[model samples]
Target: MKQKPIHPALEPYLEGKVLLVNKPLHWTSFDAVRKIRGFSRITKIGHAGTLDPLASGLLIICTGKFTKKINEYMGMEKEYTGSITLGASTPTYDLESEPENQQDISHITEEMIHAATAQFTGPIMQVPPSHSAIKKDGKPVYLAARKGIDVELEPRPITIYSFEITRIELPVVHFKVVCSTGTYIRSLANDYGKALGVGGYLSSLCRTRIGNFSLEYALSVDAIGAEIQHLKNSYIPPAGGYTDAV
Candidate 1:
Protein backbone atom coordinates (compact mmCIF):
# COMPACT_ATOMS: atom_id res chain seq x y z
CA MET A 1 0.00 0.00 0.00
CA LYS A 2 1.12 3.54 -0.66
CA GLN A 3 2.06 5.69 2.34
CA LYS A 4 1.01 9.29 2.97
CA PRO A 5 3.51 12.09 2.44
CA ILE A 6 5.17 13.30 5.63
CA HIS A 7 6.25 16.91 5.38
CA PRO A 8 9.48 18.04 7.10
CA ALA A 9 7.54 20.81 8.86
CA LEU A 10 5.32 18.25 10.55
CA GLU A 11 8.35 16.48 11.99
CA PRO A 12 8.78 19.19 14.63
CA TYR A 13 5.20 18.70 15.76
CA LEU A 14 5.64 14.93 16.08
CA GLU A 15 8.83 15.41 18.06
CA GLY A 16 7.14 17.97 20.32
CA LYS A 17 5.57 21.41 20.03
CA VAL A 18 3.49 23.69 22.24
CA LEU A 19 0.71 25.50 20.41
CA LEU A 20 -1.20 28.48 21.76
CA VAL A 21 -4.83 28.44 20.66
CA ASN A 22 -7.51 31.05 21.19
CA LYS A 23 -10.35 28.80 22.25
CA PRO A 24 -13.69 30.01 20.86
CA LEU A 25 -16.76 30.51 23.02
CA HIS A 26 -19.13 27.55 23.58
CA TRP A 27 -16.38 25.11 22.54
CA THR A 28 -14.94 22.73 25.09
CA SER A 29 -11.20 22.53 25.58
CA PHE A 30 -11.28 19.03 24.10
CA ASP A 31 -12.95 20.34 20.96
CA ALA A 32 -9.99 22.59 20.23
CA VAL A 33 -7.56 19.73 20.83
CA ARG A 34 -9.50 17.43 18.54
CA LYS A 35 -9.51 20.02 15.75
CA ILE A 36 -5.75 20.47 16.02
CA ARG A 37 -5.14 16.73 16.22
CA GLY A 38 -7.29 16.14 13.14
CA PHE A 39 -5.33 18.58 11.00
CA SER A 40 -1.87 18.07 12.53
CA ARG A 41 -2.39 14.28 12.73
CA ILE A 42 -0.47 14.14 15.98
CA THR A 43 -2.17 11.57 18.18
CA LYS A 44 -0.33 12.38 21.40
CA ILE A 45 -1.84 15.82 21.81
CA GLY A 46 -3.31 17.27 25.02
CA HIS A 47 -4.35 20.62 26.47
CA ALA A 48 -2.76 22.01 29.61
CA GLY A 49 -6.00 23.12 31.23
CA THR A 50 -9.74 22.83 30.76
CA LEU A 51 -11.91 25.85 29.98
CA ASP A 52 -15.65 25.76 30.45
CA PRO A 53 -17.70 25.83 27.26
CA LEU A 54 -19.08 29.23 28.29
CA ALA A 55 -15.58 30.60 28.58
CA SER A 56 -12.99 31.28 25.88
CA GLY A 57 -9.35 32.29 25.49
CA LEU A 58 -5.84 30.97 25.49
CA LEU A 59 -5.51 27.19 25.56
CA ILE A 60 -2.07 25.59 25.61
CA ILE A 61 -2.01 22.50 23.44
CA CYS A 62 1.03 20.25 23.57
CA THR A 63 1.85 17.63 20.96
CA GLY A 64 4.01 14.47 21.18
CA LYS A 65 6.78 14.67 23.82
CA PHE A 66 5.54 18.09 24.88
CA THR A 67 2.41 16.44 26.27
CA LYS A 68 4.48 15.54 29.30
CA LYS A 69 4.72 19.20 30.19
CA ILE A 70 0.94 19.56 30.55
CA ASN A 71 1.05 19.10 34.29
CA GLU A 72 3.79 21.68 34.70
CA TYR A 73 1.88 24.17 32.59
CA MET A 74 -1.34 23.44 34.46
CA GLY A 75 0.32 24.50 37.71
CA MET A 76 1.26 27.94 36.47
CA GLU A 77 -0.59 31.15 37.32
CA LYS A 78 -3.46 32.18 35.07
CA GLU A 79 -4.93 35.55 34.20
CA TYR A 80 -8.50 36.21 33.13
CA THR A 81 -10.75 39.09 32.11
CA GLY A 82 -14.52 38.84 32.24
CA SER A 83 -17.78 40.29 33.37
CA ILE A 84 -19.77 39.10 36.36
CA THR A 85 -23.43 39.82 36.36
CA LEU A 86 -24.69 40.79 39.76
CA GLY A 87 -28.31 40.35 40.98
CA ALA A 88 -28.67 36.82 39.60
CA SER A 89 -27.14 33.39 40.21
CA THR A 90 -26.80 30.35 37.96
CA PRO A 91 -26.51 26.62 38.46
CA THR A 92 -23.27 26.46 36.46
CA TYR A 93 -22.04 29.82 37.81
CA ASP A 94 -21.82 30.95 34.22
CA LEU A 95 -24.04 31.46 31.19
CA GLU A 96 -24.03 27.73 30.41
CA SER A 97 -27.03 27.52 32.74
CA GLU A 98 -30.04 29.75 33.21
CA PRO A 99 -29.78 32.63 35.67
CA GLU A 100 -31.87 32.44 38.82
CA ASN A 101 -32.28 33.80 42.37
CA GLN A 102 -32.52 37.37 41.19
CA GLN A 103 -31.82 40.15 43.66
CA ASP A 104 -32.03 43.92 43.57
CA ILE A 105 -28.67 45.65 43.16
CA SER A 106 -30.11 49.11 43.86
CA HIS A 107 -28.07 49.35 47.05
CA ILE A 108 -24.84 48.26 45.38
CA THR A 109 -22.32 51.05 45.00
CA GLU A 110 -18.91 51.38 43.39
CA GLU A 111 -17.29 51.54 46.82
CA MET A 112 -18.94 48.27 47.83
CA ILE A 113 -17.76 46.55 44.66
CA HIS A 114 -14.15 47.70 45.19
CA ALA A 115 -14.29 46.59 48.80
CA ALA A 116 -15.43 43.12 47.79
CA THR A 117 -12.27 42.52 45.79
CA ALA A 118 -10.19 42.77 48.95
CA GLN A 119 -12.06 39.82 50.41
CA PHE A 120 -11.10 37.56 47.49
CA THR A 121 -7.61 38.83 46.92
CA GLY A 122 -4.54 37.01 48.26
CA PRO A 123 -5.03 33.48 49.64
CA ILE A 124 -8.62 32.34 50.09
CA MET A 125 -10.61 29.14 50.21
CA GLN A 126 -13.02 28.63 47.32
CA VAL A 127 -15.53 25.92 46.53
CA PRO A 128 -15.72 24.60 43.01
CA PRO A 129 -19.09 24.80 41.28
CA SER A 130 -21.23 21.69 41.66
CA HIS A 131 -21.94 21.77 37.94
CA SER A 132 -18.29 21.41 37.10
CA ALA A 133 -15.94 18.76 35.69
CA ILE A 134 -14.58 17.94 39.15
CA LYS A 135 -14.66 14.18 39.61
CA LYS A 136 -16.89 12.73 42.32
CA ASP A 137 -17.01 8.95 42.81
CA GLY A 138 -15.23 8.37 39.48
CA LYS A 139 -17.69 10.51 37.58
CA PRO A 140 -17.86 14.20 36.79
CA VAL A 141 -19.84 16.12 39.38
CA TYR A 142 -21.60 17.91 36.56
CA LEU A 143 -23.10 14.59 35.50
CA ALA A 144 -24.71 14.25 38.90
CA ALA A 145 -25.70 17.89 38.94
CA ARG A 146 -27.60 17.40 35.71
CA LYS A 147 -29.66 14.71 37.45
CA GLY A 148 -30.58 17.13 40.26
CA ILE A 149 -28.15 15.60 42.71
CA ASP A 150 -26.42 17.94 45.07
CA VAL A 151 -22.68 17.35 45.48
CA GLU A 152 -21.01 18.63 48.62
CA LEU A 153 -17.59 20.04 47.88
CA GLU A 154 -15.05 21.28 50.37
CA PRO A 155 -13.35 24.64 49.92
CA ARG A 156 -9.78 24.58 48.65
CA PRO A 157 -7.13 27.23 49.07
CA ILE A 158 -6.23 29.39 46.05
CA THR A 159 -4.23 32.55 45.73
CA ILE A 160 -5.70 35.52 43.91
CA TYR A 161 -2.63 37.56 43.04
CA SER A 162 -4.84 40.45 42.01
CA PHE A 163 -8.52 41.14 41.38
CA GLU A 164 -9.17 44.44 39.71
CA ILE A 165 -12.63 45.72 39.01
CA THR A 166 -12.08 47.52 35.73
CA ARG A 167 -15.62 48.62 34.95
CA ILE A 168 -18.98 48.67 36.62
CA GLU A 169 -22.25 49.28 34.81
CA LEU A 170 -25.02 48.48 37.29
CA PRO A 171 -25.69 44.74 36.94
CA VAL A 172 -22.51 44.09 34.94
CA VAL A 173 -19.07 44.32 36.49
CA HIS A 174 -16.00 43.85 34.33
CA PHE A 175 -12.79 42.73 35.98
CA LYS A 176 -9.35 41.24 35.55
CA VAL A 177 -7.92 38.57 37.82
CA VAL A 178 -4.52 36.95 38.23
CA CYS A 179 -4.78 33.79 40.23
CA SER A 180 -3.35 30.39 40.98
CA THR A 181 -3.96 27.31 38.85
CA GLY A 182 -6.97 25.91 40.70
CA THR A 183 -8.77 29.20 41.04
CA TYR A 184 -12.27 29.29 39.53
CA ILE A 185 -13.51 32.70 38.38
CA ARG A 186 -17.10 31.49 38.48
CA SER A 187 -16.90 30.85 42.20
CA LEU A 188 -15.25 34.21 42.68
CA ALA A 189 -18.17 35.95 40.99
CA ASN A 190 -20.62 34.14 43.22
CA ASP A 191 -18.65 35.04 46.30
CA TYR A 192 -18.24 38.62 45.22
CA GLY A 193 -21.97 39.08 44.78
CA LYS A 194 -22.53 37.42 48.13
CA ALA A 195 -20.06 39.80 49.69
CA LEU A 196 -22.06 42.69 48.30
CA GLY A 197 -25.34 41.22 49.56
CA VAL A 198 -26.42 40.57 45.96
CA GLY A 199 -26.20 37.22 44.21
CA GLY A 200 -23.97 37.04 41.14
CA TYR A 201 -22.92 34.71 38.34
CA LEU A 202 -20.23 34.70 35.72
CA SER A 203 -21.75 36.17 32.59
CA SER A 204 -18.71 35.99 30.33
CA LEU A 205 -15.10 34.90 30.76
CA CYS A 206 -11.88 34.91 28.74
CA ARG A 207 -8.55 33.59 29.88
CA THR A 208 -5.99 36.09 28.65
CA ARG A 209 -2.86 34.42 29.94
CA ILE A 210 -1.41 31.31 31.49
CA GLY A 211 1.88 32.07 33.16
CA ASN A 212 3.90 33.94 30.51
CA PHE A 213 1.81 32.77 27.54
CA SER A 214 -0.79 35.27 26.33
CA LEU A 215 -3.86 34.93 24.16
CA GLU A 216 -2.46 37.71 21.98
CA TYR A 217 0.13 35.24 20.69
CA ALA A 218 -2.39 32.46 20.15
CA LEU A 219 -4.06 31.50 16.88
CA SER A 220 -7.47 30.08 16.03
CA VAL A 221 -7.93 26.41 15.09
CA ASP A 222 -8.67 27.42 11.50
CA ALA A 223 -5.41 29.35 11.32
CA ILE A 224 -3.44 26.38 12.61
CA GLY A 225 -5.17 24.12 10.11
CA ALA A 226 -4.22 26.48 7.31
CA GLU A 227 -0.62 26.40 8.48
CA ILE A 228 -0.64 22.62 8.45
CA GLN A 229 -2.18 22.67 4.98
CA HIS A 230 0.49 25.04 3.77
CA LEU A 231 3.20 22.77 5.09
CA LYS A 232 1.61 19.71 3.48
CA ASN A 233 1.24 21.59 0.22
CA SER A 234 4.98 22.36 0.20
CA TYR A 235 5.90 18.73 0.87
CA ILE A 236 8.51 17.13 -1.37
CA PRO A 237 8.44 13.32 -1.27
CA PRO A 238 11.68 11.40 -0.96
CA ALA A 239 13.21 9.62 -3.97
CA GLY A 240 11.81 6.22 -3.06
CA GLY A 241 8.38 6.99 -1.60
CA TYR A 242 6.48 8.88 1.10
CA THR A 243 7.18 8.26 4.80
CA ASP A 244 5.43 5.36 6.50
CA ALA A 245 4.52 7.55 9.50
CA VAL A 246 1.99 10.43 9.43
Candidate 2:
Protein backbone atom coordinates (compact mmCIF):
# COMPACT_ATOMS: atom_id res chain seq x y z
CA MET A 1 0.00 0.00 0.00
CA LYS A 2 1.22 3.52 -0.81
CA GLN A 3 1.75 5.84 2.17
CA LYS A 4 -0.01 9.20 2.27
CA PRO A 5 2.34 12.08 3.10
CA ILE A 6 1.45 14.27 6.06
CA HIS A 7 0.55 17.92 5.28
CA PRO A 8 3.29 20.47 6.07
CA ALA A 9 1.50 22.83 8.51
CA LEU A 10 -0.49 19.86 9.72
CA GLU A 11 2.75 18.02 10.37
CA PRO A 12 3.80 20.29 13.25
CA TYR A 13 0.32 20.64 14.73
CA LEU A 14 -0.14 16.91 14.42
CA GLU A 15 3.10 15.85 16.04
CA GLY A 16 0.71 15.69 18.93
CA LYS A 17 -2.42 16.91 17.14
CA VAL A 18 -6.12 16.36 16.86
CA LEU A 19 -7.48 13.81 14.41
CA LEU A 20 -11.10 13.60 13.42
CA VAL A 21 -11.80 9.88 13.29
CA ASN A 22 -14.86 8.03 12.06
CA LYS A 23 -15.57 5.44 14.72
CA PRO A 24 -17.30 2.16 13.92
CA LEU A 25 -20.11 0.56 15.84
CA HIS A 26 -19.56 -1.51 19.00
CA TRP A 27 -16.43 0.55 19.70
CA THR A 28 -16.41 3.10 22.47
CA SER A 29 -15.05 6.64 21.92
CA PHE A 30 -12.23 5.70 24.31
CA ASP A 31 -11.38 2.81 22.03
CA ALA A 32 -10.97 5.14 19.05
CA VAL A 33 -8.74 7.53 21.03
CA ARG A 34 -6.54 4.64 22.12
CA LYS A 35 -6.10 3.45 18.56
CA ILE A 36 -5.10 6.91 17.34
CA ARG A 37 -2.67 7.38 20.21
CA GLY A 38 -1.08 4.03 19.44
CA PHE A 39 -0.88 4.83 15.74
CA SER A 40 0.71 8.25 16.28
CA ARG A 41 2.82 6.96 19.18
CA ILE A 42 1.71 9.95 21.21
CA THR A 43 1.08 9.73 24.94
CA LYS A 44 -1.11 12.81 25.34
CA ILE A 45 -4.24 11.53 23.57
CA GLY A 46 -7.88 12.33 24.28
CA HIS A 47 -11.37 12.54 22.77
CA ALA A 48 -13.86 15.40 22.64
CA GLY A 49 -17.03 13.43 23.16
CA THR A 50 -18.28 10.02 24.14
CA LEU A 51 -20.28 7.74 21.87
CA ASP A 52 -22.03 4.71 23.26
CA PRO A 53 -20.50 1.42 22.23
CA LEU A 54 -23.53 0.81 20.02
CA ALA A 55 -23.09 4.13 18.21
CA SER A 56 -20.97 4.67 15.13
CA GLY A 57 -19.70 8.02 13.78
CA LEU A 58 -17.36 10.98 13.93
CA LEU A 59 -15.07 10.90 16.97
CA ILE A 60 -12.65 13.81 17.39
CA ILE A 61 -9.29 12.63 18.72
CA CYS A 62 -6.56 14.87 20.05
CA THR A 63 -2.90 14.09 20.38
CA GLY A 64 -0.08 15.91 22.21
CA LYS A 65 -0.91 19.59 22.58
CA PHE A 66 -4.16 19.23 20.65
CA THR A 67 -5.64 17.49 23.66
CA LYS A 68 -6.13 20.92 25.24
CA LYS A 69 -8.96 21.69 22.82
CA ILE A 70 -11.12 18.73 23.80
CA ASN A 71 -13.58 20.95 25.61
CA GLU A 72 -14.14 23.16 22.55
CA TYR A 73 -15.28 20.19 20.50
CA MET A 74 -17.48 18.98 23.32
CA GLY A 75 -19.39 22.29 23.27
CA MET A 76 -20.49 21.89 19.67
CA GLU A 77 -23.90 20.67 18.57
CA LYS A 78 -24.28 17.12 17.28
CA GLU A 79 -26.25 15.44 14.50
CA TYR A 80 -27.25 11.80 14.53
CA THR A 81 -29.05 9.25 12.40
CA GLY A 82 -30.52 6.20 14.06
CA SER A 83 -33.44 3.83 14.38
CA ILE A 84 -35.61 2.82 17.28
CA THR A 85 -37.72 -0.29 17.63
CA LEU A 86 -40.95 1.26 18.79
CA GLY A 87 -42.49 -1.68 20.59
CA ALA A 88 -39.72 -2.53 23.01
CA SER A 89 -37.95 -1.02 26.01
CA THR A 90 -34.40 -2.10 26.79
CA PRO A 91 -32.12 -1.78 29.77
CA THR A 92 -29.87 0.41 27.69
CA TYR A 93 -31.43 2.66 25.05
CA ASP A 94 -29.82 0.57 22.33
CA LEU A 95 -29.68 -3.14 21.49
CA GLU A 96 -26.55 -3.64 23.60
CA SER A 97 -28.81 -4.80 26.42
CA GLU A 98 -31.89 -7.00 26.60
CA PRO A 99 -35.35 -5.54 26.38
CA GLU A 100 -37.32 -5.24 29.58
CA ASN A 101 -40.61 -5.77 27.75
CA GLN A 102 -42.13 -5.84 24.29
CA GLN A 103 -45.41 -4.49 23.05
CA ASP A 104 -47.61 -5.18 20.05
CA ILE A 105 -46.66 -2.78 17.26
CA SER A 106 -49.14 -4.02 14.71
CA HIS A 107 -51.38 -1.06 15.31
CA ILE A 108 -48.63 1.50 14.67
CA THR A 109 -48.48 3.14 11.27
CA GLU A 110 -45.98 5.30 9.42
CA GLU A 111 -48.32 8.26 9.66
CA MET A 112 -48.63 7.82 13.40
CA ILE A 113 -44.89 7.61 13.79
CA HIS A 114 -44.38 10.81 11.82
CA ALA A 115 -46.97 12.62 13.84
CA ALA A 116 -45.51 11.43 17.09
CA THR A 117 -42.12 12.79 16.11
CA ALA A 118 -43.51 16.34 15.97
CA GLN A 119 -44.19 16.40 19.68
CA PHE A 120 -40.47 15.95 20.26
CA THR A 121 -39.37 18.75 17.98
CA GLY A 122 -38.31 22.10 19.54
CA PRO A 123 -37.72 22.49 23.28
CA ILE A 124 -39.02 19.80 25.56
CA MET A 125 -38.41 18.32 28.97
CA GLN A 126 -36.70 14.99 28.48
CA VAL A 127 -36.11 12.38 31.10
CA PRO A 128 -32.84 10.56 30.82
CA PRO A 129 -32.99 6.83 30.25
CA SER A 130 -32.68 4.88 33.49
CA HIS A 131 -29.72 2.90 32.25
CA SER A 132 -27.66 5.94 31.30
CA ALA A 133 -24.23 6.82 32.71
CA ILE A 134 -25.74 9.61 34.77
CA LYS A 135 -24.63 9.79 38.38
CA LYS A 136 -26.99 8.91 41.22
CA ASP A 137 -25.81 8.85 44.82
CA GLY A 138 -22.28 9.32 43.42
CA LYS A 139 -22.46 6.15 41.30
CA PRO A 140 -23.33 5.63 37.67
CA VAL A 141 -26.96 4.78 37.16
CA TYR A 142 -26.01 1.91 34.90
CA LEU A 143 -24.03 0.42 37.79
CA ALA A 144 -27.02 0.61 40.04
CA ALA A 145 -29.24 -0.81 37.33
CA ARG A 146 -26.86 -3.75 36.88
CA LYS A 147 -27.31 -4.50 40.55
CA GLY A 148 -31.13 -4.59 40.04
CA ILE A 149 -31.58 -1.31 41.87
CA ASP A 150 -34.01 1.37 40.77
CA VAL A 151 -32.77 4.96 40.83
CA GLU A 152 -34.73 8.15 40.36
CA LEU A 153 -33.53 10.73 37.87
CA GLU A 154 -34.86 14.15 36.95
CA PRO A 155 -35.87 15.36 33.50
CA ARG A 156 -34.07 18.31 31.97
CA PRO A 157 -34.76 20.64 29.07
CA ILE A 158 -33.37 19.55 25.72
CA THR A 159 -33.89 21.08 22.34
CA ILE A 160 -34.61 18.78 19.43
CA TYR A 161 -33.90 21.01 16.43
CA SER A 162 -35.51 18.58 14.05
CA PHE A 163 -36.57 14.95 13.91
CA GLU A 164 -37.46 13.33 10.62
CA ILE A 165 -38.70 9.77 10.29
CA THR A 166 -37.33 8.41 7.04
CA ARG A 167 -38.75 4.91 7.05
CA ILE A 168 -40.87 2.61 9.09
CA GLU A 169 -41.46 -1.15 9.22
CA LEU A 170 -43.72 -2.38 11.96
CA PRO A 171 -42.10 -1.40 15.24
CA VAL A 172 -38.88 -0.15 13.69
CA VAL A 173 -38.51 3.51 12.75
CA HIS A 174 -35.47 5.03 11.09
CA PHE A 175 -34.82 8.72 11.65
CA LYS A 176 -32.34 11.59 11.92
CA VAL A 177 -31.94 14.17 14.66
CA VAL A 178 -30.03 17.42 15.29
CA CYS A 179 -29.81 18.24 18.93
CA SER A 180 -28.05 20.50 21.39
CA THR A 181 -25.19 19.54 23.65
CA GLY A 182 -26.07 17.25 26.58
CA THR A 183 -29.10 15.87 24.75
CA TYR A 184 -29.43 12.11 25.03
CA ILE A 185 -30.85 10.38 21.95
CA ARG A 186 -31.47 7.25 23.97
CA SER A 187 -33.82 9.14 26.21
CA LEU A 188 -35.45 10.56 23.12
CA ALA A 189 -36.15 7.06 21.83
CA ASN A 190 -37.65 5.98 25.13
CA ASP A 191 -39.77 9.11 25.29
CA TYR A 192 -40.90 8.69 21.69
CA GLY A 193 -42.20 5.24 22.56
CA LYS A 194 -44.08 6.53 25.56
CA ALA A 195 -45.84 9.14 23.45
CA LEU A 196 -47.23 6.39 21.27
CA GLY A 197 -48.55 4.43 24.25
CA VAL A 198 -45.84 1.80 23.68
CA GLY A 199 -42.31 1.79 25.05
CA GLY A 200 -39.39 2.05 22.63
CA TYR A 201 -35.60 1.88 22.55
CA LEU A 202 -32.81 2.74 20.14
CA SER A 203 -31.66 -0.19 18.05
CA SER A 204 -29.15 1.83 16.02
CA LEU A 205 -27.38 5.19 16.31
CA CYS A 206 -24.66 6.99 14.32
CA ARG A 207 -23.24 10.45 14.83
CA THR A 208 -23.26 11.93 11.34
CA ARG A 209 -21.63 15.23 12.29
CA ILE A 210 -20.47 17.54 15.03
CA GLY A 211 -20.30 21.30 14.55
CA ASN A 212 -18.77 21.85 11.09
CA PHE A 213 -17.14 18.42 10.89
CA SER A 214 -18.99 15.57 9.21
CA LEU A 215 -18.33 11.86 9.08
CA GLU A 216 -17.91 12.26 5.33
CA TYR A 217 -14.42 13.64 5.99
CA ALA A 218 -13.50 11.25 8.81
CA LEU A 219 -10.83 8.53 8.58
CA SER A 220 -11.75 4.94 9.33
CA VAL A 221 -9.95 2.90 12.01
CA ASP A 222 -8.53 0.53 9.42
CA ALA A 223 -7.13 3.37 7.35
CA ILE A 224 -5.56 4.95 10.41
CA GLY A 225 -4.05 1.65 11.50
CA ALA A 226 -2.56 1.14 8.05
CA GLU A 227 -0.79 4.51 8.24
CA ILE A 228 0.20 4.41 11.88
CA GLN A 229 3.95 4.07 11.61
CA HIS A 230 4.26 6.80 8.98
CA LEU A 231 2.46 9.33 11.18
CA LYS A 232 4.91 8.87 14.01
CA ASN A 233 8.04 8.77 11.84
CA SER A 234 7.61 12.25 10.30
CA TYR A 235 6.18 15.51 11.64
CA ILE A 236 7.13 18.79 13.39
CA PRO A 237 5.61 19.10 16.84
CA PRO A 238 2.97 21.73 17.54
CA ALA A 239 2.43 23.57 20.84
CA GLY A 240 -0.49 23.62 23.32
CA GLY A 241 -3.07 20.80 23.53
CA TYR A 242 -6.82 21.19 23.10
CA THR A 243 -9.59 20.13 25.44
CA ASP A 244 -11.83 18.51 22.81
CA ALA A 245 -9.38 16.53 20.65
CA VAL A 246 -11.07 13.22 21.34
Per-prediction TM-score, please? 0.94, 0.85
Error of 1 at 7 (Å): 4.4
Clashes of each: 0, 24
Per residue, candidate 1 scores C-alpha lDDT tens digits across 68-187 of 999999999999999999999988888888999989999898999998899899999999999888998899898999999989999999999999999999899999999999998999
Tens digits of per-residue lDDT for model 2, 85-189: 888798777787888787888888777899998999999888887787889878788888878887788989888899999888767889999998889999899
Off by over 4 Å in 1: 1-8, 241-246
Residue-level lDDT for 58 in candidate 2: 92
Please name the candidate that would achieve the greatest lDDT relative to the true structure: 1
Q: Model 2, residue 164: what's the lDDT?
A: 94
Candidate 2 scores a C-alpha RMSD against the true structure in Å of: 7.0
Model 1 backbone overlap count: 0
Query: Which candidate's TM-score is highest?
Result: 1
Model 1 local distance difference test score: 0.91
